[model samples]
Target: MKDLTSAVEHRQEHRFARSRDPRSAAKILVYHPEPEDYVVGIRRALPDAEVVFGSDPDFLRQHIGDTEIILAPRFPVEALQDAQRLKWIQSTNSGVDFLVPVRERLKNTLVTNARGVHGEVMADYVLGTVTMLHWDFPDLLRQQAAQQWKPKFVDPLSGKTIGIVGLGAIGAEIARRAKSAGMTVLGMRRGSARLGEPVDQYYTREEFDEFLSRSDFVVLVVPATTETYKLVGAKELSAMKRSGYLINISRGSVVDELALIRAIGDGQIAGAALDVFEVEPLPPTNPLWTMPNVIVTSHIAGNPTEYPRRILEIFFENARRYLAGEDLINVVNLARGY
Candidate 1:
């Protein structure tokens, strides 16, 4: 009889061995708006490696040729044409849509993301927004502005159903918090019927409509991918409960912005809390900015005071694995677009 677990371990070992040769000496490029102590941490972790620090396109272009590794939130995809020796890229951001522009060029490059780091803060944002909508925070704000003394009935979060569209790290954290608040947590993910802690029920993509119908709040946390592009369209929006609120902490492309505007205008759903947009800066002329039922944030959900430190922890650990010829954490499957 074959030992399945040992066989799986051996297969993984062989796969990583074929991926990259163990090399302590490599050129690393650090390009981020707020790297903080990342360069220092990377230096300590990979003492033999040469580190180049720059945020300007010209400086990055000048050093791209010799860069074996890159640590950044975003990089110019077009400039990657000059990076002849690039082997791996570690994105400080969890979503890697920034790499989509040059997906073909990254076929051979190993890519990892800062995934688990943002969950806590992002979950807090979702909870806060959900509570605001449920408790009618907007009405109170308007009353304060007009010096009115009206008291509106608020809905309790207890026993309310929250359907999280993606059961990744961020979604799991949200489920944890929602469950702690006595809310019924439902989760939708790619596959598997198994229910984990925090989530009481699990649904696959096939059962998305049923999930939407059951939820009092629908949260989208899926990554931006071809399969997920506009995953929440008019049809999906119309399936939700009339009083259901939508919260998007994921990529803007994951939901149809135009469809969302229509849904809100037509009262297909109660309202939405959006942290990301299809066109960011979201344009001053965009209707969402002035919508009474909607709450728009400039995509700062994952940005806490400790965000840089958290991201650096992932990067530093991955650097150790890269030099030790071990499989890296959060290695993105380019084909899967996660």
Candidate 2:
């Protein structure tokens, strides 16, 4: 019988023998309670690569010895030091600030993120919240409680404009949905002057104030990076139209929670829908919980039951590219911090 393992070994033998550096098999460790199919699919995509399953942090510590790549939702900053063999890390989530310290220390390790997967779910969440606000659901709830049939005026989605702070996957999807609902859509990002499909206009960071001034609703979908931290704080908040509403489906730290409180308290903006906060499990005493004009959720905007399957698809695609020595997709640019 022919040796299948030797066939794979022969294909890599010349590359191994000629290189001054040792050519070891690529080994990946996945950290998260991910679907088994995710790991299995990636392994199938790169048959020669060694894939290990480690759902717990303790298992991660023990298995870091041979890990050349890590598929993680989040991991301890200390893991960067111990995982000396780690050459890359693929985060299942968009925000990576929690991994910044580790990223800084592991200068050579490449980092990729799942940027496109969560867009649809997040867009749907934003649209739902915005629609609820436009229809005055809160006011209607009060009237129901009081047993009153008071008629009130509500804003129409057709004539209004929505400004998206980031034109990435999530922002683009939001634009598409908002436009289909007859709202004018605008977006602002650090680069790219042109908007795709549904966006009527695109602005650079310098044009943020202009975008804010004209928007009746502003949606934030940017990731939490050095450049985006507190990007929508006091000054930005003050730039918007007083009757304008704000929606944050991005990370909490992207907006200054204190600044937002002051802005809303002073009636700087009409209302806000926040899905993420600076602190996880926001303390019961947090003022945001009591604010009448605010809608707060526990960071569930981008979550969907299909999340694991979507994440696995990206991993498998990248894993196949890795085997072919192709440049990986969605590779994070450390300097730009996306």
Candidate 3:
């Protein structure tokens, strides 16, 4: 276990120490590659917990049955299913789709996420991609390759409608930047009506298509769930302004890849900047890879900066709350998937 990053330094270690209750501290298993990189800080955070850190799947499988709390980015579902005394799980990723495999077994356990951490970096990346989509950088690059100098007028970010789906932490940051750039920000989510939100207008789940039709640019940031699987399909694409562009920073399953390909081919939508796909490493034969109008990035929207220091932040706070008998933050609802 080697600390690959300086993320869990001394200061963060002391922040949690004051809040932890020695008597209430439970055994914590930090399962990650080179688990020691974070173990020192985690141990300092909850001084009384029996902190066993490991990178081996077999070691995790061997110890998981007696562990009360698990902080891991990856865990064998079979081992996860056998946890006897597990009370809480701190998932390192904002999206907990991986846990779907063990959702039924952990009905009694609490699940939380590292969501807000990616907000700033992800928003910056999404907005940059959105700008590329709007400016038709692909076309410009093609012209550059052809050595053709054709200047075309394009609308500025200001006054253009930018609709955000799944207005969570990432979406909110996007809205803030869009607003700063003078763009009209529209947002959709379960309870987007909350006052003081960054969005200029809010749409509910029922008005999904209506929401889709109005935006000049649509950004998908929703979680991948049964309700959101292929949330953007043929009809949904048809709803958008044909000139509009899509920027997906969400899971690939959230959008229908085949429908998106067909839509792009037929010009149902202008183009897309895709960071995720239905199948990762996006099969070489996939049309999106070669499409001049699309930008495909291997799922890296959340990590413009690595070292999940933010996830550890969430874990630290939650660990304190768990020991203090306080309500945890980022508690996930498995059924809704956010």
User: Which candidate leads the pack in TM-score?
Assistant: 1
Ranking by TM-score: 1, 3, 2
lDDT of 3: 0.80
Local distance difference test, candidate 2: 0.78
Residue 290, model 1: lDDT of 89
- Model 1, residue 332: distance off in Å is 1.1
What TM-score would candidate 1 get against the native? Answer: 0.89
Q: Would you list the rank order by lDDT, best first?
A: 1, 3, 2
RMSD of each: 5.4, 4.6, 6.2
| Model 1 alpha-carbon drift over 4 Å, by segment | 1-25, 44-47, 193-195
What global local distance difference test value does model 1 have?
0.83
TM per prediction:
0.89, 0.85, 0.86
Give the per-residue lDDT of model 3 (tens digit) for 101-169: 678877767788887878998888888988888888988999999999997998788969999998877
> Model 2, 224-261: lDDT tens per residue?
88788898989999999998889998888889999999
